[model samples]
Target: MARTRIIEIDPLTRVEGHGKVTIHLDDHNNVDEARLHIVEFRGFERFILGRLYWEVPVIVQRLCGICPVSHHLAASKAMDSIVGVDCLTPTAEKMRRLMHYGQIMQSNVLHFFHLSSPDLLFGFESEVEKRNIFGIIEAYPELAVKGIKMRKFGQEVIRATAGKKIHGTSAIPGGVNKNLSLAERDHLLQDIEQMIEWAQEAVAIAEGYCVDHLSLVQQFATFNSSHMSLVREDGAMDLYHGVLRAIDASGNVIFDQVDYRDFNDYLMEEVRSWSYMKFPFIKRRGNLDGWYRVGPLSRMNTAGFIDTPLADDAHQAFRAFAGGRPNQMSLAYHWARMIEVLHCVEKIRQLLHDPDLQGSDLLLRGERREEGIGVLEAPRGTLFHHYRVDNNDQVTFCNLIVATTNNNEAMNRAITQVAKAHLSSQKTIPEGMLNKIEVAVRAYDPCLSCATHALGRMPLDVALYDAAGNLLEHRVKDGR
Candidate 1:
């Protein structure tokens, strides 16, 4: 009889939050199953219950430190609906857009430069100690410096609009709290051109890597799947606000321009016994086969065109390279991400020159409502925020379907594909082969802490094992 064994990478590195990957090998050494498990959980939805409706916008920011602005804005937009405001003032909308674009630009830069660049620049199987952001700083100092400055510029934009870098109370129900001053606009303008130039360079690097390594990019953790995102009324890429859109692998529309308020009618969340995170799928397509991907890759596939000039050209080239079909390569996410960065910088420049951002009309209000829903394209993907308020001004219900949760199933599939491709039929799994599995998960850029919505306490455990199936070290920490 052949022996069966399991390999686990607990507390996965480089990605946000706490999670692990488990790979099961059959008796013949062929891969049987692989799963990306969320070992940690945070109850932000439960925590928000009973709080005043107005405070939820600021409280939701605690869901993620890296993309707090996304949660903050999404919650605020929902509250806008609760207050019965269908549209915001010109100054208010523009200010919020500026804040959102800054958030996306900075978040994407951090992921590409610090988190995923090491694997892309150096080979995925490179030495563990050397394959990191520090190594990039040591070898490519100029590129590293540019990444820092670009991120700094984006943060500065946030500070000017949102009042702080981490969590600001700028966005409120129906509108924003402050408008951009002339000094802030001038300061941001000074660095806008350089930011655009650097963003372009980043896109070229990602694009070149994919073109040069076509075979690897095509087959590595890649499969034909459905994609979803938000798009402008005219079918342009609009991250801050738009109706819902989903497309299949062949680039055909599954759904388009559906109001986000009725998300319940189309989307369903499936809970499995094995995972703390929930898998979301289209209700019409059935839970099993309706699973789709979100984030930069899906956004690229769903967006009909980019409104900006330079980014539009880049988008056209990217689509042409895929023969006008949805690009299914997981590795191409970096390229699509950089294109978004470029588009953000372009939008920032245009917003700074506009006089509406400096207008005094900041707040608007109308008839009140009990329930509201808001959806936006976050740095990771589509984010949904829904809330119901009681007459006492207290929150009665809260439900959040974050970007990471939307991609949970897709990430697991990617890990399974990579593990089977690289580790099957091997006598012993090398550390490098393990890194390949990580590469696949990292492509999704999942936020485990945000996706995990399980309540109560759970214990944590850590174990180190040698190639000979012997435990080298074991540790466990009790959870409250």
Candidate 2:
């Protein structure tokens, strides 16, 4: 009889938060199951109850250091509903969009140059010690410098529009607490051309990588799944505001311009025994077949066109690379991300040039309502924040469906695909092989810290079971 075994990569590196990979092998050494498990839990949804509704935007921003601006905006948008405001003031909306675009630019640049570029630039099989941002700096110092400068520009834009770089309490229920000054606008304008140039260069770099490694790009953790994002009524991409849209694997739009307040009408979250992260899927399709993807790749596939000129051109080129179909190759996320970064830059320029950006009309007063729902396209993907307020404007219930949670099932399926293709009967696994598996998870660029919101460090454990379900070997790593 063939022997059964399991392989696990504890404490997945180069990604945010605590996670691990587990692959179960059958008696014939065939892959039985693979899962990407999130092992931490933070009770943000439960604990936030009883707080004032106005406090939510500030509190939810604490969910993630990397993309707090996303939470801030989403929660603020929801709170806007609680205050009975259907629309924010023109200036308030413009400032918020500027800040949101800044978050996207910073996040996409960080992911591409700092996290994923190391693998693409250095090769997945390179020496572990040298396959990081530091390695990239050592080899291509100019590129590293450009990335740093672009990220700094994004942060500066955030600082100028919001009060601070991280967790800025500028966005409030009725509107923003601040407005852009001509000086601040001028400061950002000075860097707009530079940021745009760098974004274009980044796109070219990613496209070259996709072409040079066409086979690996196509094969790496590839799967057919539905994509979801926020889009304008005319099908243009809108990160800060729009209706939710979902498209099938064949690129057919299943739903478009659906109000996020009724998310439950189409989307549902499922709990799994193995992880704290919830799996989200389409309600009508059921869990097994309803799983869909969000984030850079999904946004690119679902968006009809980007409003910015340069980004729209890049989008067309990227679609051509996939032969005008929805891109299923997981590695294409990097390409999509670069296009997003370019869009952010161009959009930032347009916003900065608007005369309304300098207007003093930042806040709108309104009476309190009992329920509110907010949704926005975060740097990673679509983020939803729903809250119900009591008569006193205190929060009664809160629910958050973050971007990473939306992609949970897709990440698992991607890992399984990578494991089965690379780990077949290999008596011993190399660090490179393990890195490939991690690469699949990284393609989604998951923010586990935001996904689970756990406080204490969580250790990672892996175990092998025999055909009879008896544990044979185990490994553990303490998280720092």
Q: State model 2's lDDT.
A: 0.88
Model 1 per-residue lDDT tens digits across residues 1-480: 655556666656777777777777777778877888886677888889999999999999888877889999999999999999989999999999999999999999998998899999999999877788899999899999999899999899899999998898899999999999999999999999999899999999999999999999999999989999999988999999999999988988999999999889989999988788999999999999999999999988999899999999999988987888999999989899999999999999999999999999999998999998989999899999999999998999999999999999899999899989998987665667777887898888877777785322323234434445766444443332
Off by over 4 Å in 1: 1-3, 453-480
Tens-digit lDDT track for model 2 on 1-480?
Answer: 777687776777777788888898877767777898887788899989999888899998999988999999999999999998879999999999999999999988998888888899888889987888999999999999999999999999889988898889899998998899988989888989989999999999999999999999999988999999989878899998888899999999888889888898999999999999999999988989999999889988999999999999999998999899999999999999999999999999999989998789988878778889999999778899999999887889999999889999999999899988988776666778778887888888888989888544434456666767777666665555
TM-score between candidate 1 and the true structure: 0.95
> Ten consecutive residues with minimal summed lDDT in candidate 1?
454-463
Q: Poorest 10 consecutive residues of model 2 by lDDT?
A: 454-463
TM-score (all chains, Cα) for each model? 0.95, 0.96
* Cα lDDT computed for each candidate against the true fold: 0.88, 0.88
**How far out, in Å, is residue 397 in model 2?**
0.6
lDDT of 2 at 7: 75
Candidate maximizing TM-score: 2
